[model samples]
Target: MKRKLCVAPSFNCDDDMEELNVAALSSRKESVAPLTAERDGTLFRHSLSYPLALVLRLRVLQIVCGISTLVMGSVAFIEERQKFNMGLGIPAGGFSILAAAVSIHTSRGWSLVTGGASVGAGAAGVLWIASGCLLIALIVQSCRTILDPSGLDNGDGEAIEDYRPSPRDLIVIACVQIVLAASTLFSAVVCARIDCTA
Candidate 1:
């Protein structure tokens, strides 16, 4: 009877060891899960300092510039009677806004995504460059019309009216527009080059 009791105790110890092994394995699995999630970029959020962090500070600057450009472009278009102002303002500003939003959304922890944000950024860069070119042309034309009204006159005695923005105002508007376009262009270049694997 004593031998039987000792043998039963030994069998119980084996069961205890097996349970401990299973518990250890489960604990290991639990620990590994979070690491995998973090590796997949789903577990943690990144700050603005990282080049491709989830919240890019540069995008905020871009949004501000975009809004200013949009407003300026609209005002110039209406006040200057320049169709090119609206053309430059609306699309370029809207594109900058849209691309920044997408970049903010698609960038993950310490990295950017594969397709959407990058492509949008590249397209935005091109649009900004285009806007800059258009602004340059508008400035040249306004300057020519202001400096030598007779050069563009067609014998109708069409005069540079008081309603048209003055040379100073035109220069201010064009300069602001060009600066915003250039800034947005720089931001786009930064965004487009963000590394996905980092």
Candidate 2:
């Protein structure tokens, strides 16, 4: 007796396997994780609790400096009694006034611009001593504020809910102010010496 060879039919399931593979890939693509944290991960969100207070203080100081510069500019104009010098003083005063107004209006950009203009005018051979003194005061205040951080915090027993500038930051600001003051004073002395010899 001869035995017939048994054969099984081969099924075409390539399409089904392809579909399953596509589905698996799609699911994996949909399950991706975020690269960053949801909250407090943004750059601006870092240490923003006390920015308002700091801004306010800065604005006030800028206003004060601007006003002082304006006064000094006026004095310079009177002392010089020259048309060109008088015009310069008027513009400087106007800029200082504008800076004060901007600071009061809460426009930080304009205020900063005006503050810079006021300082520049002072540095350009007008009201040197007053500008130097103001800078010195600002530096001293910055140092005091930095060394005593408690003033920024609420004295209540509740949890501290605000950000106060660190002593280190204060020290840095102070150093910068001191440098500025010294430079202004030096410039003023040199100007005076030159004027005396001339």
Best by lDDT: 1
Query: lDDT of candidate 1 vs native?
Result: 0.61
Give each model a TM-score: 0.51, 0.31
Kindly give the stretch of ten consecutive residues in candidate 1 with the minimal lDDT sum: 109-118
Task: Encode model 1's per-residue lDDT on 1-198: one tens digit a residue.
Answer: 455443444457788999999999999999999977766433244333445532377878888888887888787676566646433666667767776766565554323233333335465445556644654554454455445433324578675564445546655666677677777767666665653334
**Candidate that would win on TM-score:** 1
| Model 1 Cα RMSD, 1 decimal | 12.4
Off by over 4 Å in 2: 1-126, 149-161
What's the lDDT for residue 141 in model 2? 48
Candidate 2 structure quality by residue, lDDT tens digits, 1-198: 999998987866998899999999987766653333345533343343323344445545544545554454444334333323222333433443454344333332233434433323323333434444454554454455445533344556443434433445445434543443344344335434433453
TM-score (C-alpha) between model 2 and the true structure? 0.31
Local distance difference test, each candidate: 0.61, 0.44
* Candidate 2, position 191, lDDT: 37
